[model samples]
Target: MNTTTSPTSTKNLVDTAAANGSFKTFGKAIERAGMSDTLRGAGPFTIFAPTDAAFDKMPAGQLENLFKPENKEELVSLLNYHVVSGRKLVADIGKWEVAKTVNGQSAPIKLADDKVRIDGALVTSADIGSTNGVLHGIDKVNIPTKQ
Candidate 1:
């Protein structure tokens, strides 16, 4: 598990996800949640990004339904579960049993045998750098327990 990925990309978290290609669904979710500007803004944030394949695992039409304007609140809550307040490296995150997210909920963090898991999503890639923060690619979308 290579956690501390070294990079100097000038793009923000949103742009970094866009360039990753695999994060199309996560990127769109961010936009739909109206968080593109927040993620693009200055100051460090850590994002547990879910890959498009992860979104595919959702119940059929669930993703599309979440995109509807009426459900934006739900979408925002879900997306915010993946975002932390400040930039956190894998080791830093590992110290947190449950990390406080921007959405007011805490995501459970697990580090075992050198692998990292957040809210039941396995981190496939770690420590991707962006201008404002770092991102880790997850194998699943992390839904809050309440939802």
Candidate 2:
């Protein structure tokens, strides 16, 4: 079986995720949200990236709906909800009960049976470091609560 490993170098977040191959769906969503430039820009970000399988698990038609041009705002909001402004490793995440996302909302972190969960999604892979951030792979897609 192929295992996903974190990029150790200072590669940018977008490039790192693309190189990993596990984040193709997410990469597309990032582009659709017009967030490529932002994610590739300065300061560190902690992204809880959902794998392709995670996106697949979304209710049928939901992902398609979110991709619609008119739903851009919603898609962007959902994507932003998965990102925190600072680079946070697994250890740092363990120290917090809630992490504030770039979207201006808080994502609750839960520790149970030695597993870390964010917004009800399981953190399947942790601490994938990048040039501008770190990424954790989640098993399920996390949708931001409607404002």
Candidate 3:
């Protein structure tokens, strides 16, 4: 079956993920990182959005610290680790250890036993269609690639 999605249809995916309560933190972080506009834009994007559970795993003050004005760059870097340069699906991302991110850094892609993982985050849901790009829900937030 053909699974390509258009930007208009991404809303349904976002809405569905939200309603399921699995992506609340990811949704909020997207807004906080000021990435809603970019992700919602036209083009194919691969979003490795961290789940609410993932956010809960952070240290007591880490999440709050990341949202501070002083830490915007860090937050941006962290979020950028979740995105790639294009709409890369699991089949297209085999065995690559590094992929360029929107933040001008690289993210590690681990493909083992046909199980593809970006950083340590598994591709829980893939091929989420958006007008500009694609959204893939990830289980964890990937750490930024060091400069």
Model 3, range 30-100, lDDT digits (tens) per residue?
A: 67888776766654567777778788888799888888878877887788777776767667775577778
Clashing pairs in 1: none
Please rank every candidate by lDDT, starting with the best: 1, 2, 3
Q: List the residue pairs that clash in candidate 2.
A: none
lDDT string, candidate 2, 46-74, tens digits = 89999999999999999899999999999
Better of 1 and 3 by lDDT: 1
lDDT of 3 at 6: 50
- Over 1-112, each residue of candidate 1 has an lDDT whose tens digit, in order, gives 5566656787889999999899998998888989999899996899999999999999999999999999999999999888898888887887779989888998988988
Deviation in angstroms for 33 in model 2? Answer: 0.4
How many clashing residue pairs, candidate 2? 0
Q: What is the lDDT of candidate 2?
A: 0.87
**RMSD values, in order shown:** 1.3, 2.4, 3.3
Please say which candidate is ahead in lDDT: 2 or 3. Answer: 2
lDDT of 1 at 24: 94
Q: Which candidate has the top score in lDDT? A: 1
